[model samples]
Target chain A: MAEGSFQYITLAASLPHLGALFSNADLPMSRYRLEERLSMLEDEDRRRLDRIAHVTSWPGVDGCDTDAEVVARFEAASRSVQAHPDLAAVVRERLETRMLVAALRLRRDGAADPAPVAAWGRTAIARAIRTNWSEPTFGLGRARPWLRAARALCAAGDHIGLERAVLTEVYRQIDRAADDHQFDFEAVAFFVMRFQLIERWQRYDATRARGRLEALLQSTLAGAWTAGNATPTGAGMAGSLSQ
Target chain B: MTDLVLVLGWFGLFAPVALGAIGSSIGCARAGSAAIGAMLDTETGYGRFIGASLMPSSQVIYGIVIMFSLQRDPMTAEAAAGVFGVGVLAGVALLYVGIRQGEVLASAIVAAKAKPEIFGISLAPAAVLEGFAVFALVFALVLSGSIPG
Candidate 1:
């Protein structure tokens, strides 16, 4: 078989696996059609798309491909979804899960430099969270289960996992605040700063992460002026400190 | 007559500031409520609250400028009087703007309190309202300064 043809076949085969990874109670197979019309492209284009599948599925499987090459393929896939808005959500969800799983595996393998892949995972998770949260039709009340799974997945990793855990806790706090009808400007500010910190850490910008952490702490102090029912816990305090 | 006009102008200019200050106080209080909501429930976005808090000061600054302009040209009683009238009108308009802005800020606070995650996208419109008020104040200041004898 020709290299190009082989790549197409591999991508075809991997689609099912990708689809399976994203499958669960929340996202049923009906919601995500893995067998939909695959993009017909030139052999070179097919090869490029295949690289994304390869990187996300098995980054260690050597193809002498650079990170830029992988990122390009992923970006292209991202763009493709944009062009076909109907397919955007499912494709993004599948791709994010694949990247997250790959990053987890890399961390498990004790890769000397897993930062980049882990960062990608963190970004993908953040996007997923935002997307899920923004769906007005879905309603915020129904977000807890999916959020829990995503949070757990994030918590299972290393340093990145810890950051994700803190973020998840913050989101939980926000949820609790809403339920109790005690939403205050100061607490909201703290969460926004927390989100910024995680975002900085995801980009491997330690300086920004540290700065955001300090800002979050300062905001917490300033938040004392509001004085609501929710007690700032030691865990919450520690999480900000670690950031 | 010039002193009266000058006084009127100062009053007009400061009126907006007073209204803006009240608006800001309300906005800040609304934000506080949202923050409390966030603390009690899930996390709410505070950026909107902070933005609302910052918005009212623009009117206050406009009032200060108008007062200064009137004081600077007190000798030109006719010009000062004319400027003062315009300033008063602007201040009244600004007062209305401030009150409306405060209400919008309050609504945003409610939304933020309900869903903190949406904060990244929700603050855009409220900011736009605040921007309009700022523009009005700026225009008033410019107009106040350009009044001729």
Candidate 2:
């Protein structure tokens, strides 16, 4: 065969292999089933699977070649998965377990480094626990662990970790209040503002602080005006803070 | 008879001042309620805001003094009646202005609560109300002298 024709045939053959690999990797399955299937793949196919997994995993590649390049890669991977529907569960479960273990290891070793990466790990783990765990079974006694982990990361000057924890708690409180149909706008606003202020303080810069405050005021005013609520009386608890 | 006219004239001159006091009291109450509303979420530093709301009533007190001054003088029946009518008009105006001013003060308190940085801006409208009350009080003083023997 001519050199060009040989190259074409090789490429065409690889496409099917790639499709099989994508399907086997992207499919969702129980954590154990995923591990079992991954163990069964041939070495070369497993290597390809690893490359795709790393590409799609948390804190995925940044500063890509171009938007088109990124989209093409994602689309190809997705298309490959679509061609082999049976592998979906295994792919998903493997990714989830891998992420959970990586996050846990990072948390365990985070105390020594206390770097941004460690902070990210802590946050990821907290999120995983929340998503995978629920009330009465896994959630009841787990809050303290997450809080402790977050606090440790924060003490290490992990702004991202602190922010993640603060935001998560704030959202949890908001959700709870919403579910209960209790309107505590003032309390919510106050706590949220305090969290924002703390974040600003951690990332200390005078100009940025002023800008944030100005933006907060503008947003607050806009929110009130849009809601058609009573304009806040200047005499309220937040009066001093406003000043 | 002149003494009686003077006494009546004094009463007329003071009537508006009394009306103003009533108005101020109402205004103060409304302003207090608004301040309370603003302070509900954050209970600190409410005392100062409450004090500011009470500031407008000083003019009402002044109107009362003018009316008392007229009572001490002697005047004719015609002068007394004229002064009395003016006093009534001034009192009615003071009352109306006071209540409206209270509303403005309430708004100011709310503003202060929300934006302590801009609380000063809220004071302007309340000041305007105070200005009108002062104007009414001045009118009462002027009319007090017109009471008959």
Candidate 3:
């Protein structure tokens, strides 16, 4: 009967169900529609949702210069959303999942030992990764069944597969949290998080990225040749550089 | 003492209607909000959602019936206790069932919006709750017959 509960129920009901990850290539709802529904959230809850999104979403962390900086942002964001324990756990779980993937990547890159727990700031997951660095799944295959597939994908250098597997796991995590919340702030957060994954996955186009990369390489080579030929005019190489 | 008893008798006579109305209002509000929200997400079936939300409104009508059933010739201390017990308890049942029905109906509306095929079946739980409200109503009516006029 409280005002906030009514608003949450409305917001929740307005959101169309996002089916299982990869079930739909297109998003169930548009960003504009989602933001409009989200407008009903209380100011404080809205702030928390923003913080959580910034810490977890790709666009939110685009400016971070280092892994440690990303972890610091996650910590702050997670702390801000502490009022919702499920969402808070979600933030932590996301950070740990990413850290685990990073660990797997490190192993694939020929690292002799696991990265220190300080960088990842997930002591439990980090320690597991450290102790089971030689193990294919980092000894977490039981709980996180996707770990084995993720490790295999990392080993095979299947960036796309790894991305899909990791996103699927993250999506599953958000989905699990959603089971406990229907018409509350936590439910809204879970909905937004899952929507983000769906949007991100739909946006992913490996072929387009590869094409763009090749075009950039050609342009850079052409710029280098032009700079080399400009020697007749006594132009400095640095000056002739296209960048 | 007799005056207090007479006042209680009158309070009992109207309690079912008052309490049931409160419950129905809250239940209908909860379900109706969900229905309105679902309407924003779907293209059709607005009527079904609205109908589902009205399911809780039956509580108020049941309350009214109980009010009529518990009506006696005149307010008397002898029958005050019996009427109070039956009227208040029935009202409480209606109130509780009404609110719970609203919660379930809201959930049902939201779910049925997602998978339209389940709309009819999703209402089973709410129907069960309506059965509970009827139980309270029928029993209150049957019990009212035994109260001394």
Most DockQ-accurate candidate: 3
What order do candidates take by lDDT, descending?
A: 3, 2, 1
Instruction: Give residue B7's lDDT in candidate 3 (0 to 100).
Output: 79
What's the lDDT for candidate 1?
Answer: 0.46
Q: What are the DockQ scores of the candidates, in order? A: 0.01, 0.00, 0.59
lDDT of 3 at A66: 85
Model 2's TM-score against the true structure = 0.36
Cα-based lDDT at residue B75, candidate 1 = 44
Higher-ranked by lDDT: 2 or 3: 3
Q: Model 1: per-residue lDDT, tens digit, B14-95?
A: 5655655665555454444333433333334345455654554555666566556545434465565665566667666556
Regions more than 4 Å wrong, model 2: A1-243, B1-11, B72-75
The TM-score leader among the candidates is: 3
Which sections of candidate 3 miss by over 4 Å?
A1-4, A206-243
Give per-residue CA lDDT, model 3, range A15-126, as digits (tens): 9988878874578889999999888887878888888887788888789888888888988888887777888899989999989888888878888887554576556887
What DockQ class does candidate 2 belong to? Answer: incorrect
Off by over 4 Å in 1: A1-243, B1-3, B43-54
TM-scores of the candidates in the order shown: 0.34, 0.36, 0.88
What is the lDDT, from 0 to 100, of the residue B108 in candidate 3? 99
Order the candidates by DockQ, highest first — what do you get? 3, 1, 2
